[model samples]
Target chain A: MSLPPPAARPRRAPLALRVAAHEDLGGGLRWLTLAAPDVAAAAEPGQFAHVRCGGGLGPDGALGTRRAYSLADADPDRGTVSLLYRVWGRGSVWLSQRRPGEVLDVLAPLGTPFRLDPHRTPVFVAGGTGVAPFIFLARRARQKGLRPLAFVGARTAAELAGGEFLAAAGAEVAVATDDGTAGFAGTVVDLVVRALEETAAAGGLAGPSPALYACGPHAMMAALAAACAAHGWPLQVSLETPMACGIGICLSCTVPGPRGPGFYRRCCVEGPVFDAREVAWE
Target chain B: MSDLTTRLGPLTLRNPVLLASGTAGFGRELAEYLDLAGLGGIIVKGTSPSPWYGNPGPRTVETPSGLINSIGLENPGLRHFLEEDLPWLRTQGATVIVNVVGRTVEEYAAVAEGLAGADGVAALELNISCPNVKAGGIQFGHDPRLAAEVTRAVKAACGRPLFVKLSPNAPDVPAVAEAVLEAGADGLSLINTYLALAIDVARLRPVLPSVFGGLSGPAIKPLALRWVWEAHARFRVPIIGMGGIREWSDAAEFLLAGAQAVAVGTASFTEPRTAAFVVEGLRKWLDERGFATVGEVVGLAHRAIDGEEAVPLGQS
Candidate 1:
């Protein structure tokens, strides 16, 4: 059993892309569409764009350190790429304030994106804004004549972003909310485990083995990792870290590797998406 | 067009803007964004005798106008560099300055010895100033005698022009600069990141696993400038001033404060083409000021002062 080869690292340059559309999306979520022909053409699902927020080449330009956001959608025909982000900090706040037609400095199609194996059934688990990349993933999976099963979780129905987007992208969407305002009134991981058990009992997983793909709060991903390990499922997880350079140079975004206790891998180059077995979960 | 060509001791560069060590990652990543041969030089990430895992995450935090990193000088060992990175960098036509790190003086000397006759290695920078590591980094930088000892060891091991990087955490930076220069160091890369810390309020603990990290960015520019000014005023060696140089103005300040060359550090994280932009901007700045070459601007600020005393503007 040889491991699958890693995704090829994208060659990127900073582009001053024009914002085509911006939406509030209520409940703290903001969706942005940028006219980026090259990025839209080359970006794979789970790859991200490092965007410079707020300050624009001025004396306070130092305040504009690039923040990484997953590329949520790409329309090659439209020559556009979209990002879904929560206004979490100063950087995002700056990003949220941008209007349509405004220019953004972006370094795109970065990091190792998620690779879908056609031999395995694609199952995606997302928590909160972690649903961003899955939209792109679901769309790509659909294009390949695959029906992706997506489990999306949030604190409430109002915060549940991308569930509708996932459905529109041809994925079978399952929603879980902590406040019981959504489909499954429990944790998404628990929902996934229950679904897996029921599917196993019904022999619904007979044709192809289900592979778990996730991006979420650390605790949720950890729980999902445990569940996948129990079911002997191969899992791929998209991780989030405080990143300075979205490129591999700074080595700021590192996750502990499965090699041993001290060994680590660069998140930017190695992956934002990795085999759950490759990560040393604490 | 004004000449951007400048010399840092034994190394002659096309310009005075080099990518700081650790920020540019051996010229591969940044090469995708900018032309490698276009900049002054590239000082790659610190290379150790053996591979270092560095500190565990969360390794970086963004404060006001600054970033704190506890990467602990993590690098692929010397063998990997000589095998994989060096040849690629050479093909890019980059002026490669290898920033060498080690756990002991012997290890530093060994890396220097390995790169002694390596192709395309323009110089060697001894990284005794990295604050994140426990064993060898700042431990050598803080003490003048140890700083000189490592400098002498590497100087003896390699025939390349040696520049000893000084730590801002060092109690007396000039003292260490003096010691290294006396020990046969050709130049100095002044003011690596400052030792700093950030706490997580929600978790009620330190943000970085290392507890402390080195702070860099615009926050430390003034501190770095003052040190460069002092070092240049006292010593007659070429200095590569860094720590928070983001743009042409910041690069100009370093040169005015007596740095023959400037390295763009944290700025590169935001914009990969910052060093190239600085190079272009500096040339235009010199042309606008009627200066023919970058050397004319080096230490120009210090020349305005009269014999160690402050001379006010228009009184010189």
Candidate 2:
């Protein structure tokens, strides 16, 4: 089977963009829209923005590091790019407190983006805030005249953030909660596997096989990868490794490479997204 | 305008702001965001005789105003660097200082010897202070004898000017400095990340997989500055001071502490344009102070304490 070639790496720079809007999506999730025309125009699905969070541009800044966040959506004509993040750390708290019109320093359209194959059906799996990139992915798939399927998981219904947005983007979203306070009583991986098995049993799984796209906690993605491997499906995973530079310079963000044990690839430059098989999941 | 030109012994830099090794990778990565030809120079990531895969997952953890990283000196090896990265760096008009690492003294000499034939390489910075790697990194750096042995071997193998990167974890940094300098190193690169660790309270485990990573960023600035000052006071060789240099003021402090040139390391991770920004800000700072050149500021803090007219040893 021919794999999709790597996404074209777009040129990026640190842009000082104004916060166009901010929405507290409840459950600590925040939706921030920035007026970044260049970034919106250049961003592709699975790409991220490195945002300088808190304090002034100095060594003594509250958080002297830049935090990486996936682009939730981008509108080139509107000159806006949106980020969906959970206010978990000091950086995210500072980002959440940012008022409209406050300028933010961001390095956008970084890392290799997801390679969407036109011939295959798109199936997205996300856990918690991992749903951030899938909204953009679903929108892109819809634009390409493909029906995207998404499985979103969280601890509870209130914790779920992106399923509604995914649905609005024309994706069929299935949700699973750990407490069974949402869609499926079991894990998202179990839900997807059951759905796929039932479809095959009913002979409704004909035509080109569906390709799985995933982003979530490590355990969730690893389980999904195993299921996809068993079903002979293609899977691509977006990793959320701790990164210092969203660019390739700092080799701080690394994942085990497919080469062998001890071999690793830079998650920043090589990919925030990689073919599931290319990663040596623990 | 104040002259930003900085001379480190035999090497002359257009400016004193250089992107530190490991942080800059090859010039190819930062070249996308900033103009390579504009800065003083680019110290490429530590390259070995052969490719090293480095440490496992979770290589970095963020601390208060700092970052701990166990990158283990991962590089594409000497062959790939000379064949692929060097040509592009040369074309960009970047003064390339290749940081060499090895698992053995022979390996260090081999990589240095290999780069000796490369066209664009301006100098070699021996990285004997990488704390993340187990085999040959800080192992050579902590002991003055081992540090001098590797420095002597590389110096014999290559014709290029050698700068030995010092480790803060060393029991006596000045001892290592004296050993490498006595072994024929042209200059010194002070403070290659402090050996440190961070525990994840939630998981009750170390943040980095390697357990102990090198701590960088503003948290270690004072420690790095102290080492630079001590080394400068004891030795006459040029010192490339680095460790949490985030802006022009930080760079200025390093110059005052007696660093001939300053490298921006972790700050580049926060802002890729930091090195270039420092170049401009430092020039403006000097001009405002009525200093004619960057050399005028080098080691000025020492003179203030000594209460005597002191010559900048770096110029010698």
Candidate 3:
């Protein structure tokens, strides 16, 4: 059977954008805050922004590629979104060099924001630079006055830029490192298990089971999912897939989801966020 | 007052500029960023039987002036595209040239037969040049007989204008182009992405799960131009040249090299309306020079090279 026709997905609305702030968060990571006049004033916690870099041309007026990043901070009231990215590719390098007065072409409110039930405690786990989304999620969770546990994993102490923010949110914060360069010598999954066990041991789980939300390396998420299964915990995971069109047409950023066998879903349109159990972890 | 149009057998394009298949996604996503109406035509992503899961993860990596992608011919089966994607594209208000792909000669025929009556699909481009997929891809592209066979099959199955998108990996691109043209292809789309790969240092593994991937971008432009120019020198088939066209000068180069049209793939990722910009640039240059038409520039660059001459119009 010839494949079915493509779904005519909704076009992303154009955004009126301006760079609000630019800061180097140290360790090759820089954060940019952008204001979009057109987006819904209320930006959700788990959503991401599609960033367009200017002067993609290499000193010759050549074209540049576009990239998507999770919004680490969003104030719908202020019509601004914060983007945190690590210097890895040319896109990131160009982004890091961007100055404060510069303007960028961007589309926002992409991907479903992380979904969490207020009644269920949100347990956030992050690995390396994947911690960006969770930091925003932590803030939103706290703003709702729901204190969730956050386990942030980094290779070394210098990499955990959001540790203080997570701690100040009134959420129990645990740090882990594989090389023992900073906190416990292990992955974030280990730290999450330890924290959850302590909470359960203190008889804190008599109510609704804590919901797990994790974002990081595929290996790290797979491990966290296993830990969730072991503890009978329900989890939501945010994924980072290669995507050129945030609108889902390119079919470049697809991950196996709960849909069907070998059936894939777009990380940009369907979600950059999904229930952990729904994701088919390999 | 300008002759911006060109003919590829029975098909007539307003100008000699086309969007490459697999690079431009049906013209819907990029419509917002650029003017789709300005292009000669648009090529949708590769289509196949049933939905293809494509490659695992790490499908793209940046290498100098190019990008390597092992996206494994990912697309919803043709049925979904005819039903869901085509109608929406009609609403996007642009003429769409559908790019079709299949795993077998029979599969290609079936797709052509299926799209025969579809409304809004202005033309059909047969994509036999994809490099990453294990089946079908590069197979039909690498050999003249197979490429001609597929082209002939698809041409028999569909009445719409047919374009055979040629692969750059083949030894003699002109031979492959000629085979398909004789087999009934309406025109030729030259030089899809080159087969390439990248490595992940930390994981000590190939960056893409597929191990090998197709390289596209500015890096492959020169190579693509050479193939297009070679085919143009050898055949009269209207060639849609594309590789790493980012601006007007690049498009002009392709036009001068004998391409009736050109496609902008990787540049769209960087600037969505780049194809339109190229088209406009072509118009501006032609108007300033008072050439009165685009054809005057086509194949003009080859004239300067003393040794190279247009092959006799009917060389078999």
Candidate 3 local lDDT, B1-316, one digit each (tens) = 5678876667778887777777776666676565565678778888886777787776777667777888888787788888888877776556788788888999988888889988877788898899987679689998999999999999898989888988888887778888998998888888788988898899998888888888888888889888878888888677788888988999988888888778888777655667878888888877776666777777778877845664333221
Give lDDT: candidate 3, residue B260. 78
lDDT of 1 at B255: 95
Which lDDT values do the candidates have, in the order given?
0.88, 0.88, 0.78
- lDDT at position B63, candidate 3: 67
Q: What local lDDT does model 2 show for residue A249?
A: 83
lDDT of 1 by residue, A176-233 (tens): 9998998999999999889988998997775577878899999999999988988898
* Weakest 10 consecutive residues of candidate 1 chain A by summed lDDT: A2-11
RMSD each, Å:
4.5, 4.5, 5.3
Off by over 4 Å in 2: A1-12, A55-62, A206-208, A260-262, B309-316
Every prediction: chain A TM-score: 0.92, 0.92, 0.88
What TM-score does each model's chain B reach against the true chain B? Answer: 0.96, 0.97, 0.93
Per-residue lDDT over A1-282 for candidate 2, one digit per residue giving the tens place of the 0 to 100 score: 432221223434688999999998888999999999989999999999989888533445657678899999998899999999999887898888999999998888788999998998899999999999999999999999888889998888898887888998889999998899989988889998898889878885664568889999999999999999999989999998888887888888888866853377778888899999988877
Candidate 2's TM-score: 0.94
What tens digits encode model 2's per-residue C-alpha lDDT throughout B236-292? Answer: 679899999988999999999999899999988877878888998998888888788
